[model samples]
Target: MDEQPETVPEPAGGLDRRAELSEFLRTRRARLKPEDVGLPDFGRHRRVPGLRREELAQLAGVSVAYYTRLEQGNGRNVSAEVLDSIARALRLTDAEHAHLMHLAKPKQHKKKQAVRTQQVRGPLRQLLDMMDGFPAYVSGRRSDILAWNRMAAAVFGDWSELPPQDRNWARLVFLRPEYRDLYVEWDQKASDMVSYLRMDAGCHPDDPRLSALVGELSVKSEEFRQLWATHDVKEKGYGVKRIRHPLVGEMTLNFESFRLPDDSEQTLITYHAEPGSPSAEALRLLASWGADATRAGTGASSR
Candidate 1:
């Protein structure tokens, strides 16, 4: 019989970093096949999926025992060079590499963090307002919608109508049916949200609120549970989104995310359409009508 996988109990208000590292590496390894890595495939029935412990160890120039220890969640003594070797053997992307490093060597938190509300700086809010036709918003840690402009409200519904806690992207995507209808590629958006949250979990595993949010979503949405189990992580930089609007029909918008230098936890996201395109024209119409148009179409109240 196959040995049962080891389970680590999560500490109150936090995730176990070692457990996270083990699961992440295991999933990464499971995605690969011997043929993909130039190894012989005899076409015999294999006990486990993907590369075995010995195979990965040989590829990484490490002993089977050492690799087994690492895979079993003992990475305290692992070196950077060994990590690099393992990462190369796993064929991890840049984002996945960073996430691996974070999981292996998570920042040590001395004490529990105080629950504090994230505030949007006045200048940043003013900057969003100044963007005019572009849909812009500020997102804080855990994908919280900290602040947004009129164009953003018009394009993505009036967030001001929701309670402060309900303004989060994760909640909006998973809990609200309207958002499922809003995005033309809803699955992609859902995957992106889970990836962003996974990245956040790697960085701040001790955040109680983040843990609670994950717990709530896992219980509430089966889709969220499946995606979260994949343990994917991504750094959101820029992407094109196609959304269907109630009033103006469908429009494709290019979005860019800029992390604040002073506080890396905060990011400014702006969306724009190609000049003179139909999507651009739709954006112009939405901008002219402002948030009022969104409220009228959705029956959402103003702030």
Candidate 2:
């Protein structure tokens, strides 16, 4: 019988840094072919897929022994120049290169330092509320829904109804079926969430809460497990989302994400529809209905 894959313990604090680095490098390497990198492919008798370590080393202008050590997860004492060379050799995207750097050279956190709760300033909260027609929300580390306006609550369901811990994109996307139905492209949404989490993990490998969240998601959602295994990383930025609102029917909205300058970890995201489009009309209708629902103490509850 085939051996079962090893499972990381649930609720553990943080990921194993070295292991994460190793797997990330391996996956990145596995996705490339020798021919893609101007290397000769000597028949199909290879024992493993993709370019071998030696081939990668040749492409990166590094010795096979040195590249092997780096691939084995010993990123210590490695310079940024070497990482740049390897990233170029791997043909990594900008986001992937940043993630690789984060994994290999994690920020040192004080073991005794307390975990501070993320809070949106009153001014920022007011800014969110002022964006009357746009659906706006502030998301902190781990995609926690920090603060949101009535429009956001209307478009994305009332986050106020959820407990603090449940106000996370990872939980809402993978654990709640309503969200799966909300996104027109559910698979893309799911993949995006996992990629965001992976990027966060690279930055905060010693974060206990993040580790617990990953562990919980891994145990509860097989889809999360598969995505997590891919070791993908993405930086949240401007994008378009096609949403199927229960009340509004179908609407395509463009979203912009801005990382707060004062606190880089907190991002302000807002959604808008093209002017005079059907989606814009739908959003206006939603805004009106949402205001009425809020006054009646019955917010837009997902079906």
Candidate 3:
């Protein structure tokens, strides 16, 4: 008989990631008003915050037992139809819907297919290059900077200063010290990143890179660790960001993200301050510094 060697077991945190999500879902749902759901308060004494379990089950087109089991993390496979119904019951926005889908779906394992660093397409790169005045960059669903215009590199700060392998925006936001100083509203920005990333997890549930990235951030960043507990999610279509600069005080910039249908995995983000405003002037000044930095960083001639 051959003797078998004992193998060490992996560490278990004993924390239920699924239960955590369920509680958060229930809590968020309970916070909504009856009127919000087009239902009557009916001059009746209500005990809970939002709609009742029956009401939610009715709206979601699921049986009370099934919904209860789901909230308790008792289900094996959560179907798409069921998810859509629950999203509707919760009155979720597009972003929230995505987050729900991510939460319900199990992550699929990624095969070792000789993964290489991803980049933006040829035409998309040209599009960003043409926009000289605006801060523009192409980012993957995981917030990897596939490419950036000169101004984008300046405004967002260049990651090329680090090792070639460590270039993720989320990683930088959580792990890098410089990022905290870069954004004036670092807390808001971090929350937004978390929310948007949470939504993306649904869209690409099978991507191992996303799960690995999440795990890395969760372990490395104390701030990220704290925020991850909230279980909040949102679709970040457009938002105003207030940025404080070490050199130039404060500036408010509007951000817009456009999804590329063909790529599905990438989006283009642009930052614009108001025209004829102090922020515009500040943007110009920053652009000059950013241009210099980009030139030096990429070893490219001044444009």
- In candidate 1, residue 168 scores what lDDT? 88
lDDT of 2 by residue, 165-282 (tens): 7788999999988887789999999999999999898888877888889988999999999999999999999999999876768999999999999998889999999999999998
Q: Output the number of the lDDT-best candidate.
A: 1
Candidate 3's residue-wise lDDT over 44-120, tens digit each?
88888788888888888899988887887654677989988988888887777766666677555576233334555
Tally clashes: model 2: 0
My TM-score estimates for the predictions, one after another, are 0.92, 0.92, 0.75
Instruction: Identify the runs in model 1 with alpha carbons over 4 angstroms from their true place.
Output: 1-12, 297-303
The lDDT values for all models are 0.84, 0.84, 0.69
Candidate 1: residue 274 Cα off by (Å) = 0.8
Flag the better candidate by lDDT, 1 or 3: 1
Candidate 3 or 1, higher TM-score: 1
